[model samples]
Target: MVLEEAYVDNQHNNLENVAHEMDGLLQFNTDRMIFFRNGMQSALETPLDFMILRKAEQEYISKRHEAIWSVALHNRRTLPVYGVSDAFIDKDPTLSRDNTLSGNELMATLELGYLLRLTNNNRGFTERMLYVSRSGFFVSTESANKHHPGAGAL
Candidate 1:
């Protein structure tokens, strides 16, 4: 099912219908799978040096992006959700020019995903492919967790 709107809300206090909707969106059960599949490549291609910066961005988004939307839950509470863009540029600033190359062509995206051991439920979080400009960066609403199901990495 497709989500008409996407927003994180406090789960515990939320009604059953609202909770069901949130689960669907977070689980990524929509037809937007193609966007996510492509987005994985884009996120992986992000430079290694910038990984820390990217992680910082992810961390920031997890903690503060939707401060008002989340609430405590029973088992843990609410899981973090990240929405990364489809394209990104080298944040080195020293690169001088932009690295707008496709991650598929360069294999940077795949490589990074492997190195980070990221999965759809882990490393780089996204719901759809975003068209990121040169300086564009991701703004996640959740944090990466150690709770991801361990089947594969990257």
Candidate 2:
């Protein structure tokens, strides 16, 4: 899912750091699951099947946060859902309409419980440091070495 108009949080201030934090929180070894993407631009490619938007400059933080959560909860789907935006801090009238339409589509196509399972239990598995792949999934260098010792040098 592409996180359009995503910006670095003032606290984090670095896209790479944010990505690392996300990986730390989301990677799972037991299930061999990982959420992977380079940065904001490439985040759209992640296979997790959902996208979350950062609060826009003009919007109320609480309201935007609640709205996003609501959309995720109500719109459940097997396929990934993406949250698109145009800027980090600007009036983008299109976001509400886009989210609404996407949410509806997701709700129609997915089961509510399935989406919840993915989101709520994201930390259920073991964590690993990973590298993002073109396919938008995380791959661990250590895991690769264990499986094929010589592969690291290739």
Candidate 3:
């Protein structure tokens, strides 16, 4: 509703924030995903399929929060995303078609770049935090470490 209003009103300011707020609250919300997964694990004998599906979802958030290490070090860079559906001007004609297109593209780039830089290396970021088990979809990190004493050590 608010997002549609933003576009309808040509109010691009903080549009990405609006999108994020909506996404954070509803569509990609993860508040009880872990809790439910834990419940499912306790309930079922064969939870691998559930875990696999949940793992993919967890990966979306975990990998986003992963440290970039070096943005340049990665051979495969995340491509910039353009999410704007239509021109903000809505064909007012004050700006040439090429200029409007350029402006829209630039706006898309700036917004997406801002989002990527923040999310790609932000750990424990509340805005898009992962509530998954520390060891991932299967078991608690404590249980994982109990089996090995130290799960990821030499």
Query: How many residue pairs clash in model 2?
Result: 4
For residues 76-117, write the lDDT of model 3, one tens digit per residue: 222222111124223334432243244333333322333334
Candidate 2 lDDT, 1-154, residue by residue in tens: 2344343344456866889878876554423433221222232344334332222112322333331111222333222222222232125432333443443433332332233334444565334333322211122313234534453431
What lDDT does model 3 reach?
0.34
Better of 1 and 3 by TM-score: 3
Q: Cα deviation of 141 in candidate 1 (Å)? A: 25
Q: Specify the poorest-scoring 10-residue window by lDDT in model 3.
A: 67-76
Candidate 3 Cα outliers beyond 4 Å, as residue runs: 1-10, 45-154
Higher-scoring candidate on lDDT, 2 or 3: 3
Candidate 1 CA-lDDT value: 0.34
Candidate 1, after superposition: displacement of residue 58 in Å? Answer: 34
Q: What are the lDDT scores of the predictions, listed in order?
A: 0.34, 0.33, 0.34
Model 1: how far residue 142 lies from native, Å: 29
Candidate 1 segments exceeding 4 Å error: 1-14, 29-130, 135-154
